[model samples]
Target chain A: MLTIHNLQKIYNGTTVVNLTELTITAGESVGLVGNNGAGKTTLFRMILDLIRPSKGEVLSKGTNVMQSGDWKNYTGSYLDEGFLIDYLTTEEYFKFIGDLHGLSGGDVVERLAPFTDLFNGEILNQRKYIRDYSKGNQKKIGIAAAALSNPELLILDEPFANLDPSSQIRLKNLLKKFREEKQMTMLISSHDLSHVIDVCERIVILEKGQVVQDMQTTENTLQELETYFTV
Target chain B: MLLTLLSHQWKAKLRSSIFQKSLVLNIILGLLILYFGSIFLLLGFGLHKILGNMYPGQDVVGIFNSALLFCFLIDLFFRFLMQELPVLAVQPYLHLPIAKNKLVHYVLVKSVPSIFNLFPLLVFVPFMYTSVMPAYGAAVAIVWVATLLLVTLLNNYLLMYFKRQMSTKPLYTLAFGVAIVGLMLLDYFGVLQLKAISETLFGAVLVNPWLAVVPLVLLAGTYLLNFYYLKAHTYPEELELRKTNTATGGDIAFLNRFGELGKLIELELKLIWRHKRTRSIAMMSVMFLFYGFLFYGKGKFMDGFGTLIFVGIILSGMPMFNYGQFLPGWQSGHFDGLLTQKNISPYQFYTAKYWMMVPVTVLAFILTLPYGFFGYKIILINAATLLYNVGVNVFVIFFFSVYNKERLDLSKGATFNWQGVGASKFVMMLPAMALPILIYLPFGLTGIPYAGIAALGGLGFLGIIFRKQLLQWSANRFVAHKYKLAAGYRQS
Candidate 1:
C-alpha cells in the first residue's frame, strides 16, 4: 500500500536515508529493525510525509504522498513525543483524535477499550496532562492514540522502547489481534528483536539506512535476526 | 568554583539557540541597548537642570533626594514584573561536588548583574557626577551614590526572595504589591507626606553619610533570607517557580458545534490557557486595553488622525499582534502531528486561526470602546482601526505566519523569553501597524481626514468581504512552505 522510489534524505552532505526502492503490500505487517543512527525514524518520517525526501518521493495508494494528502485519511502514525500533544489529558486527546475521524465521545471510549490492558490503569482518569505522565505511560497514550481511528495503515517508531515488559507483550498481542481481525497494515520500527518478530509477519533489517535483509518470519527467524544483528 | 559556574553561564548565553540562530536579532538587540543606554545617560546629565527649571530657586539636591524614594518604589514594582528568578541554572550543579551554600550564593549574586540592576547605574552614576559630587563634598557624594547603589541591590535581593515565595506563599507577593501601591496612593492623595519625609531622610544622610547603613543592613537581611531559602530547597522541583499544574480547564462544550474547526480552536484556546507564556500574552493583551489612556485625552495626539489611527490600531490589535506573530510555531511541538492528521487541510488550519483571532480583535475593540467617550472622533478612528485590525491586519499576520518555524517552550514565562522571536516578527509588525496609518496619511494631507478614516475602514470592509480568497491565498502559501517549516522545527 506504500512505496518509496529512490528515497534519500541528506543532511550536510551525509546521506541519512538512501533507499533505491521499497514497497509494502496491503495488509502486510512489516517490522523495521535498526541500530542507533540507522535512519529508521527518518525513513518513517518520509513515508508519513513529515519530511521531504532529498531524492524521489513516497507514493501511497498510487498517489505521491507529498502531492496529495489523501494518504493521511487512512494513515495513523506516531513517531515520537512530537506526535502527542502533551498539554491535553489522555481522554481529551483521544476525543480530539476521535473527533478528527468523526467519532463521537462514546465512540472514542469504545475505540479505546482495546487499550485498557495496555494502559495498566495509569493512563485513564488520572486527571493529569499527558506531559505529567511517566515516559512509558506517555508511549502507551501515543500508541493508543495512533490506533484510535483504526486506520487502514498504522506507522509507529520505537513503540516498545519506553514501555514496560508486560505492556510491551500486551502491545504485541494487540498488534497481532488488529492484524488478524481488521486486516490492518502496520509498519513498526523497534530495537527489540523478539517482540518485533512476534508482532510482524515479515521483518526488514536495516543497516545504515539500507535494507540489508528482508525475510518472512518463521520459527527460526529470531535466531537468524539475532545472528545478523550480532557484531 | 563560583568563577567556573559563572563562565558556564556566560557560555550558555553565548551558545543558546535563540542567541546564535539570528544575527539580525542580535544586532537589533545591541542597537536597542545602545539607544536606551544613551537616552538614559542624556537624561541623567540633564536631570538636575530640568529639576531646577521645574522647582526654581530650590535645593535641586533635596528635590532629587525626595524623588529618589518614589523612583526606588517604582523600580521595585517594575522589578517584580520583569525580573526572572535564576533558580534553574543551579540544577546541573546541585548534584556535583559543589557545596549548596556556594550554589545559592551563585544564584543570588548572578542576579546582581541583570539589566534591572545595572541599567539604572547609567542614570544614577552620571547624575552623581553632575549633581551630587559638585553640590556636596566628594565624601558625601560618594556616600549618596553608594547609598543609591545599595538600595538598587536591595531591591534586587528583595525581589528574588519575595518572587521565590510567590509560588508557596503568594499572599506575601500580593501583600507586597498592595503595600507598594497603597503607599503610592497615600502619597498621591496627600494623606502621607512622602516627599517631605524623603527629603528630610536623604538630607540627614547627606549630612551624615553613616545613615547609609540602614539600606546596607536591609540588603544583608534579604540576602541571608534568600540564602537560607535556597539552602533548604535546593531540589529542582521545589525551586521551580511553577509546580506541574493539575489539569484545570475542561473542554469548552460549546465548541463541539463547529466540528473539527471547533476542535482546533478549542485546542488552541486550551494551549493558551494552559501554558505560562501564552497565558501571559493574554494577560498582557488585557493590560494593553488600558493603553488608550496614554494618548486619548491628550491634545497633541487628539487633533491628528495619524497618531489616533496608530493608537486605535494598537488598542484593538495588540493581542493579535503579540500572539499571532508566533503563529504555527506555537504548534511547532505537534506540527508534524498536525501535518499527518486526517482531513486537516491547510485551508481549514488557517481558517481556524482566522476565526480565532477575529473575535479577539473585535472583543478588544469593544473593550476599548470607552475610548470613544473622549470624542466622537475617537470613536470614528477606533471603529475604522478595529475593522482594519479584524479584516486587513489579521490577513497580514497570516501572510507572514509561514516563516515562523522555531519551537516554543510553553512552560516558561514570556517576560524575557525570546525562544521563537525572529526578525520576521518585527517585519510583520511594520505592515500590520503602519499600513492603515499610511492609508490615512494621504487623505489627511489632502484636508479630507474623515474620508481617509472612511477609506481605511472601506479597505478593511473589502478585505472582510473577500476573506475566503485571502484565506485561500494564505493556505496556498503555507502549503508551499510547509516542508521548509517542518524541517526547521525538527531541528530543535
Candidate 2:
C-alpha cells in the first residue's frame, strides 16, 4: 500500500507534479495513463524516493518514504534503463539481484521461468553485456529483474513502449498471472490503453500531474478512455 | 563545407559539459599547456649550446642531426599511445551530400594540428632559428625545417593507417614496441651505427635541398594510404577503433565469499577492467608507483621531512586519489539501481569502498617497499604516509565524494578526458596531500621531526580504529545528497 499527501514537484516555477492526496490499497493494481510531460514519471520518482518532493510527502505503509528506506525491501521498480546495470551480463545482473534478495541460484532460474516467453530466447546466455543488447531486450531484462524478488509492490514506467507487439501481449498476460496468483500490487504507467486496461483492475487517468479520473475497470472503460483521449 | 564542419567541431569542444561547467578546470588546463610550451621553447633555444658543451670538439649541427632520428622515433611512440583517431568525427557527414574525398581529406588534415605534431615544432623551429641558420645558410635551414615538418606529418598518417589496419590485433602493437626498443638497445651496444646514419641522411639534406623530395613522397604515400582507408570504410561501426566485442570478464569467485561487500567490490573491479577510461586510470596509478624515485634518490630531499612525506603520500596513495576522486560518480551510470536495491544500506556501500581501497593501498605500499633500499629513513617516512593515506586520506576522499555528481562516460579513453572532473577534485586533493605535510611541519620546525612522523601514523591509527563511525558519517552525508546526485545524473 502506498500514499501520497499533497505531493508537489516544481522546477523553475513550473509545477511538474501536484497531487493533493492519492492512496493505493493492498492487492490493488492501478494503471497511470498520461501523455508526455503529464508528470507521470516524476510522480513515480517521488513515490520511489529517488527525487525529493517539493511539498508534502509520499508514504509507504504510513512511513514517510524519504525518512526511511524500508519500502525498498518490498518494492520492485523498473522505471527506465537507469534501473539496469548495463555492464553486467544478463545472467550476472540477475544473479546479483537474486543474491541481494537471498535467492539461491536455482531460485533465480526458477523465478526467471515466467519470463521465458517474453524473453523470446534472446536474453540469457547471450555472452554479451546488457549494454550491447537491443532496446527491447534490455527492457525485458529490467522487467524480469525487477520481478525476480517477487516484491509486494511493483512499479514500472512505460513497460510496453519499446517492446514488440508480441512481447507486449506476453507481458500483459504475465502481469495478469502475477496479479491473479500472488495479488501483487502494481502501479504501471503506460500510453497503451487496452493493454493497461487488460491487466489493471482500476485505472487512474492523469493530466498535468493531477488525477482526472479514478474508476474501476468495466467493459466500456476502454471506450470511455479512448473517447476522453480523442482530442 | 569544410569550414562549417570545423566550426561545428569548435562549438562541440566549447559547449562540452566539462568545458562549460568548470572555468577553474579550463584555466588550469590552459596554464599546464603554457607551462609545457614555455619549457619546450626554452629547451629548443638552448639545445645547440648544451650539445656543443657535451661533445666539445664535435659539430653542434652534426650532433643535432644525429639525434633527429632518435627524437622522431620517440615522438612516434608517444603519438601511438596518445593520438586519437579522428574517424568518428566524419560519421555524421557520411550520409550527407558531401563528397567522400573531401571528408577523407578533412579527417587526415585534422590530425596535422594536434599536440603530437605541433609540440615538436616548438623545439625544431627554435633550434632552426638559433643553430641551423648560422651553420647551413638561410635556404638550407628553411629546407631542413620543411623536411622535419614533412616527416612529422608522415608519422601522423603512418600511425593512423597502421592503427586502423591492426586495430583488433594488439600483438602487432606489442611487436612494434619491442622492435623500437630492440633498435635502441642495438644502437646502445654499438651493434648499429644509427647516429652515423642519421647524421649522413640529414647531412645530405643540408647539402642538397632537392633531396627533401624523399620525405615529401613518403608523406604523400602515407596520406594516400589513410585517405583510401577512410574512403572505403566510412561506415561508423567500421571506422570505430574497437568494435563492441562480447563481454570478456566474469565474476570473481573468490570475492563472493564476502557476501554483499564482495559483490560490490567485484562489480567495481569489473567496471575498472571493462571501461577504457577506468582501465587507463589503473595503468596510470601503476606507473605513478615509480614516483618515489624522483624524491628518494636526491640527497636534499632525503634530508627533508616535507618533500619525502609528499613523495610517500603520492607513491602509496596515487591509485586511491586517481580513482576515488570520482567516487560514486563512477557508479553514476547505475546509481539509481544501486539506491533502490534491497538491503544495500549506504553504510554497507561506503564500507565496501573502504575495504576495496585498503587492500590496494596496502599492495601499493608493499610494491614501493624497495624504495627502502635507498635508505631506511625513506622506508620509515613511506610507512607513516601509507598509514596516513589508508586511514586519514581515504576518509578525506569519502568526505568530498558527495560533491561528485557528474556522470562519467566510461567508454572513452582517459587521455585528455575531463568528463566528471569538476573543480572540487582539485580542491579535494589540496587537503589530502597537504594535511599530512602540515601535520609534520610543526615538528620539523621544532627540530623533532621523528615525533612528527609518528604523529602522522598515530592519527591514521586513530582513524582506522574509528572507521565505523567515519563510514557511518559518510553514509549520512550521501543520503542527504542522493536526490541532488540522482537529479544531476538523470539530466545527462
Candidate 3:
C-alpha cells in the first residue's frame, strides 16, 4: 500500500525521478524493471523518505511518508549497505533491530530460525563484523534484516544482485512464501527478469524516470517484457 | 609505467569529489599554511638574533649545531603524528601491470610533497644563508645545507618505518617511546649530554664538508629499508596484518536498562573503542584531563580566573567538542539504517547524546578534583566551569554540529583527514570559547571575581535544570535538518 503522486526529484535541471502517478495496492507484489538511470533506486529512496522529493509526496496507507513516522513502523527497505550497520555483528544488528520493533530476544531467535537456511550457516553464530562479511553475504544480512521486523510492506532494490545462485533461489522461494501465506505487500526492483517474473504478480517497466508500462502478470508477460527490453 | 600511475594519481587528486566540494575550505587551509610559512620564515631570519639573545657571548653556530639534532628529533616526533602512509591509495593499482617497486617508490616520493618536509627548510634555509654562508664560505655552507636536508629526509624515512612497525606490533612503539624518554632523562640529568654529543657530530660536519656523506648514507639506508619493507608486504593479507585488531565485543549491562536508546549509546561506545581513529581521539581527550599539570605544576594561572576557566573547559569540555563535532557523521556508515528501519524519534536521539556527555563532563570534574588540593578556590572554579561546560557548551556544540553536513569516514585516522571539517567547525569555536569568556570576564572585571565564577556555575546549573527543554529544542532542530543530513550521509 504505497502511492507516489506527482513525484519528481530534480538534480541541477535534470529530472532524476518524475513519476506522475503510481500506486501499489494492499497485498500486491510488484516488480520494478528499469535501465541504470531509470530512477528505480531514487524512487525507493523517496518512498523511504531518505531523500526529499522535489515536487510532490509519497503516501503510505493514506499517510504522507514525509510528514509522519507512522509508516516506518510497517515499512521495510534494503536499498544498499546504508541499510545495514557494518560495525556490528549480524546477531547484534538483528537484536538491535528486534529491540526497535519491540520484539523480545526469544521472538527474534524464533523469527530468524526460518532464515537459517537462507543464511547458509555463514551469517548466524558467526563472530565476524558485518564489515568483514563478503558483499554477497552482506546483501543477505541486509535483506534478512529488512524482513527481520516482519514489516507489512517490504521494498528491496536489486535483491538478486550480488547473491549466489543458491541464495537467490532461496530468496525467491522465501518471497513467494511470504506473498502467499502472509499476503505481504512487496515492491522488488531487479534487473533479473526471470526472478521478477517468477515472484511478482504485477510488473512495471520504467524508462527515463517515467513509467512506460504497467501490466498484470500473464502467461506471456515474461516474453512481452523481454521483447520490450531488447534494445 | 610509473609515469602513467603517477599521472593517474595526479588526476585522481584533482578530480576527487572532496577536492571540488571543498574549494573554499582548501583556500582557507592554504591561507593558514601561508600564515605558518610566514612565521617559520621570520623565525629563520631571526635565528642568529634570537640565539644571541638567549645565549649571550656564545658562538651562535655552535648553539645552532647543538640544537639541530634536537630540532630534527622533535621533527621526527611530529612526522610520526602528522604523516599518513600514502601507499594505501595504491589498492586500485595492485591488479594492474605496475611493478610493486614502482608503486612503493611512488608512495615514498609522494610523501615528499607533505608540509612536514617543507617546514624545516623554511626555518633552516634562511638561517643557513644569513649565519653559515658568511662564516663558512658558500661551498661549505652548501655542504651544511645539503647535510641538513639529508638528515631531515633520514628522519622522515626512519619514522615511517617505525610507524609501520608500530602499527603491526604496538610493542615497537612502547619500546621506541621508552628509548626516547630514557635519552631525554639521561640528557636532563648530568649523566649524558645530548647537546654536547649533537655539538660534536654536526660541528664536525661544518669543519669537514666531506662528512655530509654520512648523513647521505643514513638517508639512503632508511629509504631502502622502507622500499624493501613495502616490497615484502605488498599483498593484501600482509597489509591487513599491519592493522591492530582488538577484541570486538564489550558489554555494558548498565546501558541495557535504557531500552533502545541505551542500545544506541552502547553501540556508540563500541564504535569509539573498536575504531583506531575514534579510540585514539577518545584516549587523547582523557590524556588531556591531566593537561592541567602543565600550568598548575608551575604555579601559574593561580589567580587568573580566566586561565583557570580555560583549564577547566579544556579538561571537561574537550571530549564533547572533539567527539560531538562529528555528530551524525560519526554514524554516516549506518545513518540510513538509523533513519528508516528504526522508530527512533529525533528527540530520543538528541536526549541520548545529552546524557552521554553528562558522564564525560562528570568524569572530567572528578579527575580534576585533585586540583582542588592545590587550592579550595581552584576546585570551586573547576566545578563551576564543569557545570558550564556540560550545560552550555554541550548544547552549543550539538547546535553547531547540525551545520556540519559533511559525512566522515570513521575508519580514517583523525590527524589530517578533513572529511567532516568546513567553515562551520571554525565558527563552532566562537561560542565554545567566547561565550564562556563573555560569561566570566565581567565578573573578573568587577571587584568580586568569585561571584563571577559562581554566576557561571549558576548559569550552568540553570542549563542543567532546563536540559529537557533544551534537548527538545535540539531534537526539533535535528528533525528539521534530518532529510538534508540523511542525504549528506548517503553520499559516501
Candidates' TM-scores?
0.69, 0.69, 0.68
Model 3 DockQ vs. reference: 0.02
Clashing pairs in 3: none
Per-residue lDDT value at B327 in model 1: 91
Model 3, span B1-492: residue lDDT tens: 556556656655665556667877899878999999999999999999999999999988899999877778778778877787675566544422234577789878877766887788997789989998898898998899888888888888888887888767789867876787787788889798889999999889889999999999999998999999887666443454334464778799999999988987888888887876787679778878888887774555785788878887787787888898888788888888887766688888888888888898898788778877777877887888888988888899879767877877777678777777877887887788777877888878987788888888898999999999999999899888888898888775
lDDT of 2 by residue, B1-492 (tens): 567556556655665657877888889999999999999999999998899899999888889999888888887788878888886776434322346677788888778878888888999999999999998889999999999999999889888887777775668767777888888888999998889989999989999999999999999998988888777666555678877676989889999999999998998999899889999999999999988777887889887889999999999999999999999899889999999999799999999999999999999999999989889998899899989998899999999999998989998998889898878998999999999999999999999999999999999999999999999999999999999988777645
Candidate 1 chain B: worst-modelled 10 consecutive residues by lDDT: B91-100
Better of 1 and 3 by TM-score: 1
The TM-score obtained by model 2 is 0.69
Docking quality band of candidate 1, CAPRI definitions: incorrect
Q: Candidate 3: list runs displaced more than 4 Å.
A: A1-231, B169-173, B240-247, B297-300
Query: TM-score of model 1's chain A, to 2 decimals?
Result: 0.98
Collision pairs in model 2: none
Best by TM-score: 1
The ten-residue window of minimal lDDT in model 3 chain B covers B91-100
Q: Candidate 2 at residue A93, lDDT?
A: 74
lDDT (Cα atoms) of all candidates against the true structure: 0.87, 0.87, 0.82
